[model samples]
Target: MSTFYDCLLTGTFVFPLLGSLVLALSYGRLSERASATVGVASIGLAALCTLWVGFAFVDQGKAAQTLTLWHWISVGDFQPTVGLMLDGLSMTMLGVITGVGFFIHLFAAWYMRGEEGITRFFCHMNLFVFSMILLVLGDNLLLLYFGWEGVGLCSYLLIGYYYRTPANGWAAFKAFVITRTGDVFLAIGMFLLFTQLGSLNIQTLLARAPEWWSDGGLMPQLTALMLLGGAVGKSAQLPLQTWLADAMAGPTPVSALIHAATMVTAGVYLIARMNGIFLMAPDVLLLVGIVGAVTLVIAGFAALAQTDIKRVLAYSTMSQIGYMFLALGIGAFDAAIFHLMIHAFFKALLFLSAGSVIVCTHHEQDMRKLGGLWKKLPLTYAGFVVGGAALAALPLVTAGFYSKDAILVSALVSGHDVLMLAGLLGALLTSVYTMRLILGTFHGAPKSDHAREAEAGKGLVHGLPLIVLIVMSTAIGAQIHPPLDEVLPPSVHGEGFGVDLVEGVAMIVAVGGVLFALWLFTRQRGLVRRAVADPRGARLWQFWHNAWGFDALYDWLFVRPYRELVRVNRGDWINTICNVAPWLARLSHDGLRRTQTGRLRHYAFSMVLGSTLLLLFLLVG
Candidate 1:
């Protein structure tokens, strides 16, 4: 018999899946309240189980624990089991997924009150949590891939939850198709890893990789690059990043839980989990850092151009993931995970708080039209400022400062001075965009009736989550420990942190970014408007507004070519074979129809003649 602890670790993923099944099977029969109850209870129980295992793991100081659930797949020499592992890395992710996840569910219960398709919404949300849990806890790479795509599938469903809107469905498809582009690369990489290593079992691979594979091998570099493709798609890194901003069509909870807090962070976790493999390929590691640096700066520029509140948050998510990627590039796996934790808190808080404001304003999302809401929606204002400050990494008292600073410090001292400069520029943007979001929406005078009506629709469920995440955003960093570098490799972290010239420079840049945002977006809003109205300025505005024309580029390059090919082929080569049988049948039937034109006498004559012919042919043969 298995102990509760073993089941508990696995249950953190399974229970939500079970809840999803229940909601799906009983769809439409349950009321909104009932669906919310089941959804909250399912994740709530998962959170409790996480707490249990966390305490035990800490108290006992266990190295790692693997629960063999059952045999999953077998084919002669290839066998992968259904199992769950609890180590420092996975344990931390579990705490984040279940703990922060539970609050998101709670907030959703209230945020989506009386909305249509509530059951369907919760079902997809619960399933997303399950998939994310599987992603973090799975014992093997194949199973992790299952979890990885599961989150992608759930994201599509949730984003298209409001199918009445044509834009929503398009957004969902965009997210699905773009991410799948990366998945193809991941599948190929997995095939190569299995072929070379002879196993996808993570533990075995991690343990035996160094012995079996030489350093600086082409195969390893190729595999790392492919896996990086998968990470880029899921985490919204550059080139594959245009999908996330449009994904704002989903519910606020979906945006918070999937796009911001949990799912988008999967790329960082994947790289961190496979830290051993990446360490062997120095070139690949450097590439990861460069991609992260460029993405952070690009995404920050995109966020600065956004007008919709959620789109700003979406771009913010991409930028933050870039920071985590930079940390991975610098070989600071622990710092990556640390920033991931803090980012989750503040980003989720920001999204949930945005949802509350949206609910009061009757779903208006344009920040230009939303202003002076801080006075009416005090709780939401407080939550937004707290979360934004964390995002900005305000000198002290914010969680983002501790975690993001750790990454900045690591980058500075890692002998890659150029990347350190890139890191500083990105941090400045982070602070700038965060302040832009606050001042444009909350600091200016009320521009519309909706902005003035921000305080009416408030609930305890909504307030509870905002308060919890606000507290987390402010304090979670001070308490964050380094990720499990003991199990993972090439963390490149040093002991004891202190302030120095580099740190001083980073803080000054962050503060300057914040001050500039206030001056340009708040006090000098008119001047900013006049600048944007000019032809050159407007061109830049439109450029960033459309995500650097990536969508248009993909449409022209990929979508149009495939569509034109389909049109040109018309029936295609396979369809030629399909046409032959139909044409032959039509010819035979036409001849037969001419003979059957008259009557019963003609049919009788034909049958007699056919019998005579059959006898003659059989005898001759």
Candidate 2:
């Protein structure tokens, strides 16, 4: 049984890696069907492995297990092994990555049919799955960092998959650079841990953290702050979150995989996995909640102003991740992981459904240009309604309701009344924007030729994943929360009238947001348009549309100054100094080439001269 478990653990990541290699080696040789089959089957197999291993682990009483494959690094008293850990935390992550990732891969097979570079697409997708699996299952921080950078690389490659577009390239670069900023902080944190504690093994480092640094001490706060830096960056939390909406430049499958299932959730996974270190750093933990609360409100507002369907979902992704961060911040690790899993289901569904809409409408993604698509694309409409309900956290029926309610409840029970209020407000914003997206895209008459002539996708590949995801986006999916009691710090469940009151308020806010949006879009549509056409209203819309002008502010504060510095230093003394060796080498090369004349006399003369010079030097010595 142990050996079988090890094999399953190893196979979960290996299968996708092997598929990636196969697709890469057979690039352009395999048909689209062949590539898709390999990609989908690989992740599907991994997903099966995850389920088997998960159930077996639970059946065996849910104790944490570790499998050491081999020693990875060795130095003076510093050795880290290539090992896998299977606790409830990692098990939950495995299910999310493989389970949701498999569906995304399957949907891509249909969405990417007849597209250029299909083999390359599958190869990158497979590699992404492998990287995310490596990230969540690694036993040590070093191995986890390897997977961390791997996902960043894959995101860049996939985001710029359409290399023909300069904008896509820039978007990919933006995401890579911004995330790297956070990764550097993570790297520094690792360095500090190893220097002070003499280890990078996660479990060891965490167990020793309390002994090394007392609670609320400078060291603990600094380390936790560094970790938070990385988490916020990867999870698309504030200040570093400007890249996500632009990342919609990638194919919809890439968005679903990266934004919905894997990359964005990595931060939540990190914080949750290291709950011990965080428990000691109370200030940093509270800051985590604050960042989350503020970000959710900010992202919700931004989502409200988005015109692009995928961009709207992108902002919503940021908002949803904020909720996870909120859970993490408030010491509700279980709720965070639970929401992470549930968000994976519904967000992936929404993105895939949007992909269906995009493909059917001739790749038009602007909600303003899409309308009357409900009947033409009933499957997609159903997806939108179901997924949007979950996104909006609509009452008790949606999967999001359970997970999200857990977060708000945690905020209230933790005495973070302000954060709880922010959460409710964000919930209202989420519902409003989600309904705006639905009504603006599908409810009105066809807004353009694309929508008017749209055709729904046919095939099991197209419909099966959506059907599965729709089911998962409901209360049925909420019932399958991982047994996290052993892995994460137990959440404080508030009882009595206050808990019920909070839940009631949350429910009302969610339903009310949806209803308000319905009324505004259906009845006060002209009033809304005219108000937006007003000067002040237009500015507010523009401000929110531009994500509160963060990108512009960043350009002014960082990008512009850097560019100016580079321009000013283009020919500085340092450049001249660095160029000296190359300049001399180039001069010597030219002089030597001149001596290499194609004439026998020239060769003989050069040889004689060289001999004479050598003889003179020898005589002098």
Lowest-sum lDDT 10-residue window in model 1: 490-499
**lDDT of model number 1:** 0.87
Task: Give me candidate 1's TM-score against the actual structure.
Answer: 0.92
lDDT of each: 0.87, 0.93
TM-score of each: 0.92, 0.97
Model 1 lDDT tens row, 30-78: 9999999989999999999999989888776756888888989889988
Model 1: how far is 271 from its true place, Å?
A: 0.9
Worst 10 residues of 2 by lDDT: 1-10
CA deviation > 4 Å runs, candidate 2: 595-621
Which candidate comes out best when scored by lDDT?
A: 2
RMSD, every candidate, angstroms: 3.7, 1.8
Q: In model 1, what lDDT does residue 380 have? A: 91
Question: Which ranges in model 1 have alpha carbons more than 4 Å from their true place?
Answer: 493-499, 579-621
